[model samples]
Target: MIEPMADPKLSHQLDDKTDDIKKAADVVAAHLKKLEQTQKDAKDDIGSAQWRLKESQIYNITKHFRQIMNQYNEECVAHRDRCKKAIKREFEISGIRRTDDEIEDMIENGFPGTFSFS
Candidate 1:
């Protein structure tokens, strides 16, 4: 006696289901790859933002220090002028008749008994 063959309709249905499952798996894999790339891009963007923030902070700090230095220099200049005026007044009161240019030169170049290393 000959053995009976399997049903063709059942085999076709199984093949169709297998193909559907494979297509679904492929879609899932593609989605996962896209998600991974998106994550990497987000990390890179965060790093770039951090660097920009750091640079801005550095620039602001430098600008602040520069302003402080400029203010200090202005105060020093004002003090120096006051000292020069006081010295000129003292000289005049002591019967010393020196010209404006001479007094300025003496103040900048150091007086005879003044301690100057520059």
Candidate 2:
């Protein structure tokens, strides 16, 4: 079932809105890829290490994993920000007037779900 836009004027804006959403998704994907690579590097480092579970040595072993986790979290935040910008643009182009609370809910929910505009 194809649901048509209620406003015909907004229909013409669909292509541009979709492009913005795709660009936002691509930005997120790129960050995620970086996060994955960071995790892989941490794993390889741990696998190659000769660990005897010494206190200081254990700290060294865990540091890389911690760094990777921090980087992954940062990427997650970046993805959220990108999604919010895309959603805001979508709402603006479609001329959908939303309250700040409603927009916040949509941003928090991210893409490809009930809350998404695209």
Winning candidate number (TM-score): 1
lDDT of 1 by residue, 1-118 (tens): 0111134454345447647855765675566556545545665555687656755665565566557656755764675576566656667667667788876786565443222212
Over 1-118, each residue of candidate 2 has an lDDT whose tens digit, in order, gives 0232334345446546656756775675566557555655665455443422333444554565557556755765675565556566677778777766776685444334323454
- Model 2, position 106, has a per-residue lDDT of 54
Worst 10-residue lDDT window for candidate 1 reads 1-10
TM-score of each: 0.49, 0.45
Candidate no. 1 TM-score = 0.49
Model 2: runs farther than 4 Å from truth?
1-53, 108-118
